[model samples]
Target: MSSIIPGTQNALTAWQPFNGARLSVTSKTSGVSSSLPNSLQVQIPKVVSGPIGFENTGYWGIKVQSGWTYQGSFYAKSTSFSESVVVSLKSTRGTVFASKAVMGISTSWTKFTFEFQPSASADTDENVFNVAVDGKAAAGQTIFFSMFSLFPPTFRGRENGMRIDLAEALAATQPSIWRFGISVATRWKWNETIGRLEDRPGRPNTDGLGLLEYLNWVEDLGAEPILGVWDGISTANYSDLSTWTVVPEADLQPYVDDVLNELEFIVGDAKTTEGGKLRASLGRTEPYALKYIEIGNEDQFQPESYAAYRWNAFVTAIGAKYPDFEFIATTLPSTALTPAYQRIDFHMYNSPSWFTANAFMFDDYPRNGTKWFIGEYAVTSTNDTNTLGDIPSGRLPYPTLQGSAAEAAFMTGMERNSDVVFASAYAPSFQHIRNYQWTPDIMTYDASRVVKSTSYYVQQLFSTNRGTHVLDTTPVSSNDTAPLFWVASYNNETDVVFLKVSNTGSQDLVANIFLGFTATDFATATAISTPALSPISGLFNVSNTLEEPELIIPVATSFALPFSDRFNYTFPATSVTVIALQSTTALEV
Candidate 1:
C-alpha cells in the first residue's frame, strides 16, 4: 500500500487468480520496508496446463484506452522458477490489449518496471491486468509480490500523479483554490507521505497521496493551496458528547511546532529550515506558496475550548513566525480576540428555496473587519425543520437545475459583497458514483465517466468569468422583493463587463445592463437551464446523473446588437446566465 500511486488500486486485496491456478494472496513478513508489513504470497500447483498467476480488475475494471502507455512496477520473488514472467492487460473475451515480458525473477526480491501500450481501446471498462508465469516451467513454485502498481498517463505526466480524466474535469472548472480534504485528527498526518515510496511510515494507509503529490496537483491546476493544519481537536462520535478529544492548551505547543515545520517545508528556503531541507531532498528545491492556513474546521462545535485557548494557542505560535499569512477561524467572527483573525470559515447546507430567499445574505454584513471564507455551501432536499421522523424521504442525490439556479442567485450576492466574502466554493466537490457521503457533490464520477452537476457548471460560469471590479447596479424590481438577482463587474485589464444574473422566478425577465460607458455592442452569453420545450413543472427537477450527465449544461451563444452604454438581455426562467461584454474601445464603468 505504501508504494501504490494515487489512482492505482493497491496490493493483493482486489486480485484473483485464473482458473486452475493454485495461488492464494496473503501477507508475508519477510520483504520490503517496515512501513509496509505485508507482501502477497502466491503458491502454484503442479501439472498445470496454462499460465499460473494473478489478475487485477482495477477499482472494478481497468479502463483500457488506446494510445495510453501504462507504467507498472512490482517487487516479486519466487522459491523456484525456470522462465521469465508475463504481465498483460486483456478483456474478458481474451482480447489482449497489451502485454510485457519481464525477465530475471530470482530467489531474492527485485523491483521491475514495464511500460506497455494497448493495441486498441476496450469498448467498456471491463478489462483486467494480469501477472502470470509459465505453468509448465514453475508448476510447483511459491512466489511473493509486494508494492505493485500501474498508472496511466497522469496530470503533467508526473509519477504517482493524478488520473488524467478526473484531473482534466476538475481543471476545466478553472478553480482558484484546492484543498486535499485532510483535516484535524491523528489520522490526518502529512509527514506520513513524504520521505520515500515504501518507507513513509503510514500506519495502515499508503503514503502515496501525500504532501508533495497534493502540492504538485495544486501547482498543475494553477491554484493556490488552502492548507488546513490540525488544531488538536477530534471527536469520537458526533451524537455522543462524552468522547471528544481536545488537547489541553498547555500541551498544544508540540503540535503547533509541527505545523510550523509543515509550513516551513512549503515556504522556507532550502538552506534555512529543516523541513525545507527535507523538501529539497525530495526534489522540490524552490518553496511552494503558503497563504491561507485554517486553524481548525468546525471549531464552533467546541466553542468553549476554542474561544478560551485552542484558537489562541496555535494562532499565537504560527503568527509569531508568519505574520503576513492569513489565519482562518472555524468559529464565528468576533472583534474581541487579542490576536486578531483574518477570516471565518462558514458552511451552509439548506433547501433550494432557503438559498434563493437568502440570496442577499451578505448585503447587511459589515465590511469593516473580518472577511469570510465560504468553506462549504450546497442545496439539499431537506430543510432545518425539526419535524418528527425527519429522515429525508426523497433527498436530492445530485444537484438539480432548480437548486443550482437558486445557488447562482446566492453567488451573485456573494460576488456583490466580494470585499466581505473573500473566497467561496461549492463543497463536497467530487465523489465516486458508488461510494459517497450524504451531501450531494458537485461531481459524480466512475472509472469511465464524469458528471459535472448543474451547480458545478454554475460555479464554473462564475469562476471563469470573474471581473476585477464590482460595479454598482440598480435593483431590477420596483420593490425589493423581486425574484431576479444580479451583480455587475468590470474587468479593467480585459475591458470586459461581466454580469452574472439569475432568474429564480418562473417568468422570464428582460433586464438592461446600464454599462455607464461605451463598449462593444455584441456580447457572449452562456446559460444552464432546462430546455424551453420542457414543462414548467419539471424545470427544477432537471439534473445530471450517471445515466444522463449532460441533461443540463451551459450553452454559449454570441450575437450582435446596436448599443453603447447599455444592453438588454432576457434572463431565462429558473436559470443562471453569465454575459461577457468585451469592448473594442475603452469603457470605464
Candidate 2:
C-alpha cells in the first residue's frame, strides 16, 4: 500500500561533478607531439633513441576495474616483419596494468588486441593508456599505430547498476516480470586462435560483444540473459562473415547444433571444466543468470534466410524445450505488432539529430498489439569514425554533456511508455580509450580507471531511485515570465517523495509548491542540480584532464528544512533539480 504526499514544496540546493579532478594529456618525449588521426585520438611523442621502442612511457592508463575480460585494438605496421612488439599498459609507479604482445608479421598493417581480467592482485587507478612495441625496432623500419582499446571481462555485480543487493531490492518491489534473453548473429565472435592471449587472430566484427560475454554482461546488469544465436563460423576477419544462412540449412545445422549445445552447458545443463557453474540464481554468490534466447542481432539484412536458417530451427529445438521463455525478433512480417512473437526489436543510431526532430518517434509506432525494445541505441553523431556519415544534430555546447542530456530525455520517453517500450539501452556502451568511434558515451574507461559523463549522473539519478507511483502533473499559466517550467512528483515506498522540476528557459522564476498529505513526520530534503551559464566552455573536445575536470560537475549546497505544507522554491534558469520531500503522513504523532 502506497500513497503520494500531495503538493509539497521543499527548498532545493545544488550538487556538482567531483571538484578536485582534472584530465590532461602530456607528452613524454623530447620530440614533437601532435594529435592523432581521429577525433578521440591523442598523440604521444615519437621516441627514437636508445632502445628504439614505441612504448607509451607517459600517457593516461586505466585498470581492469572488476571483470574477467579486457578488450582493445590498435593498428601498427612496420617496414620489416618479425620485429618484437608488446602492447602494454603500466602504472606511473611501474606496476603492470595489462598488456598483450603482438608478433610483427609482414610489412602489411596489423591490428593487435588483448582480452584479459585482472590478476588476483590487480587494483584500478587513473592514468592508463596503450603501451606499444616495448623492444628494439629495426633502424629503417618505422611503425604507425592508431585505434588502441581495452575491454575487461564481466563478473557478477560488476555492471554499473546491477549490484546483488540492488537486484534483490528491485525484485522485492516486483514492479515487472523477469524475462530471459540472448543474441544469435550479434556479438557472437569466434576466438579463432582461442588458445593464447596474443596469438588469437582478430579482425573487424559484426558481433558487438562476444556472445558468451554479452550474456554474462546482461546477467551482471541484473537483466535476464537473452541469448542471440549466430550463424557461427569463426573468422579471422569481418570480410569472412558466416554464410551458413546464405548457402543452405544443411550448411547451417552443424554450426547451429554445436553452438546450442555449448550454450546449454553455459546456462547450467552442461558443466564447465573450471568445476563451477557460470551464474547463480538471482542472489547466488556466483552471479550469472540466463533466462531468454534471441535468434539473431539485426537479422533484417537476411530476414528470409535468417528465419529459415536460424529462427525456424531455434523455434523448433530450444522453443520446444523451453516454451516458457519469450522469443524476440528484430522485425515482424509487416505490422508493428504481432502475436506470433513475444516482442519486436529495433536498433537506433540515426544520429542525435533524428531524436531531436522526432522525440516522440516511438509513439508513432503502434503498441496495442505487441511489446518493443530499443535493443541498441546511441546519440553519437558518427559511427566508428566514419565521416561521410550522418552528423547528428542536437549537439550540446559541451561535448561531454551533449550526449548525456539527449539520452536522459530519450529515456524519460521510454519510461513514460514502458507498456510498449519494454527496454532501452545505449549501444556500444564502451569505447577503447583511444579507439573511440562515436562522439559521446555514458561511461569511458581505459586499462586503469573509469570516468563518468554528464549522462552517467542522469542515469544514476533515475535508476538509483526507482519511483513506485507517478503523479498527475498539470500545466498552468503564470504572470511571472521565466523559461518553460514543469514539476512532477514520485512517491517511492521508501517513505520519500521525489519532486523533479525542470526550467528549460533562460529566465529565473520563483516557484511555490503546496503539499497536501495524510500524515506529518517531516525529515530533511536534498537535491541534485545542474546549473546553467557556467563560465566554462562546452566544447566536445573539452575534458576535465588530470589537471582540470571541474569544468564538468554540479556544485552542491544545502538549505534549511521546513515542515510546512506550502513553501516557496526558486527555479534556476536552464537547470535540473531533484527535490525530496519529508513524509508527513507516516509520522508517530
Candidate 3:
C-alpha cells in the first residue's frame, strides 16, 4: 500500500541512480592477469598524492533493483598529475555501499560514478564491488573502469542519480544559501564509546548532517534556509583530558538546557488537523517563532568568565521569551563588547582576494544598529576536515571544512552586501570522508545521502532568487568582465519578476535584459549546474559512498515560455541563474 503519485509528471518521474549508465573497465595493462576481466587492469593513480592501490582487486558490480537505478562509470589516463581516485559499492558484508573520489590532473579516460536507489538496504541482485587508488600511481600509468544502467524507479528527468531540474536549478545560489549549524555547540564531541561516525546521534555533537536533513536538502533546491542553532559550548580538558582547551562553564547550563529543549521540540513539533503532530507551530503566543537563532558558537575562545557569563545568561533567558526571534551572536573576537549583542556573527578564514581586498570588513564595521552575521566563513587553511577522506584525525593542509573558489567568491561578496548582512552560515556543514575534523563543507549527506557546493551553487543562487523590491541598477562593469553580473529586482505581488543573475566571471554572459516594458515570457528558466565549464569537474567527490550518492548533484533545465523580447541571455561563467520573469508591465528597470 504505497500510493500517492499525483502529477507534476509524477513528481517528475522518481527512480534514480545514474539514469542510463556506462563504465566498461579493462582499458589495457598489456596482458594483465589476476582474474575476472583481467581484474580491471590498473596503474594510473595520484588522487591526493601517494599510497592508494587496489591495483587489481577487481569485480566492480552494479545491476541494482527493488525499484531499479544503478549508474557507475569509468575511464582513466594520466600524463602530468595531482593524485586521488576511489570508487565503491560494496555490501557483500564488505560494507561500503556507495562512494566517489577523483581529484586533480588527468591525461585522459575521465568519467566516474556513484548514484543510488536500492535503499531499503539495497542488494536486489548485483552489488558488492571495490576499487581503490588514493593518490600517486605512475610506473606506466594506464587504468580504466566502467558500468552504467539508470532505469525506472519512476523515471522522468532523472532522480536519485540527480538532475532534478539541475538540483532545482543549482539550488537557485549564494553558497547554497547558508547552512552552517554545529549543535551542542561544537567544541567537537562524538566518541559515544567506539560508535564512530561522529558518535552517531542527532542535533549537535556531530552527526554533522541532519538539521532536518539540512532542511530537506535546502527544501529540495528551491532555496532559502539560513538556519543554525547550538549554544552548547563544552571545550573539554579535565586537565588535558584530550585537550581542546577546556570550556566547562559550569557544564554549560545543562548543555544550554539540552539546546533549549531541542529548540522546544523543533518549534513545538508543528502538526495538527485532528490527529496532531507534524511540527513548526508558532502563535502559541510566540515562544519559538524563530526565523533564525544562534548564540554560543565559538563563545569567544571559552573561559572568559565562562564565556561572558553564559552569553549574558542566554540573552537574559531567550530574550525575555522570544522577542519575535532573530538572535545571533557568537564567533566574536571584537564586535566591541558585543553591543548589548543582538546581531553580530563573524568568522572569515580569509581569501577572495581577502574578501575583495577587505571590503571594509563589512563596511568598516561600526555597528550603530547592530546586525551583521557571517557565522564562520571559509577559504580553508585548515580548521578541520569537511570532506576528502583519511580522517582518523590526520590530513590537514587546507581544510576549514572544504571551501575554495576563493571561498565561493567570498560567497559572492557576501551576497553583494545583503543590506548590512543579517544572516550567513557555511561552516562545518558536513564532513564524512573517513570521519572528519573538517575539510570542505557546504553540503555532505550520509545517513541517507546529500551533497551540494561550489559553495552550494553559490548559496543556491542567493537564497532562491531574492529581491522583493530593491533595485538601483548601475553595473556595466566595475572593472569586471565575462558573465560576472549581479542584479536584483523582485516584486512578488504576483505579477512575478524575480531576475537574479550572478555569473562570477569565467565566460558566457551575453545579456540584453531591459525589463522596462513589454517583457512577458519566461514562466521558468532554472539552471543550477555542475558540468558546464568544469569547476573541479562537476563536484560530488569528497569521497562519497553509501550506495552511490550522486557524487555532486543539482541539475535542473527548463525553458519554454517566452524569453526573447530581445533579451538574449547566456550567463554561465561561474554559474547561477534564476530568471522567472512574467511581466505585464509595471515600471522599474
Error of 2 at 342 (Å): 2.7
Mind giving the per-residue lDDT tens digits that candidate 1 earns over 77-142? 776774788899998778899999898877777898998899999998888888888888877777
RMSD for all candidates, in order, please: 3.5, 15.1, 23.7
Q: Estimate each model's TM-score.
A: 0.92, 0.56, 0.27
Model 3 per-residue lDDT tens digits across residues 1-589? 0111222232112112121121223324321111112113344332335434342121233333344455645444455444666655545445555556766536644545455544445543334444555343443354443222232232133232232433443444434344444544243321221111222332223333333433445545534554454554555532342454433557667656554554554454345321112233212222223366666555555536434566666555655654655666665544334226557677765433454334334534554676777776655433233322223233332221123333544454454555667667665655544355565565554322345555555465556656566454455322253235444465656555665554544455587666554556555655543355555543422322334344334455556545445466776544556677666766553
What is each predicted model's overall lDDT from 0 to 1?
A: 0.78, 0.45, 0.46
lDDT of 2: 0.45
Question: Model 3 scores what on Cα lDDT?
Answer: 0.46
RMSD of 3: 23.7
Looking at model 2, how many pairs of residues clash? 66
Q: Which lDDT tens digits does candidate 2 get at residues 126-165?
A: 4344344322344334444433444444235342223233
Superposed model 3: Cα runs more than 4 Å off: 1-186, 189-368, 372-421, 424-579, 582-589
Question: In candidate 3, where is summed lDDT lowest over 10 consecutive residues?
Answer: 30-39
Q: Which of 1 and 3 is the better model by lDDT?
A: 1
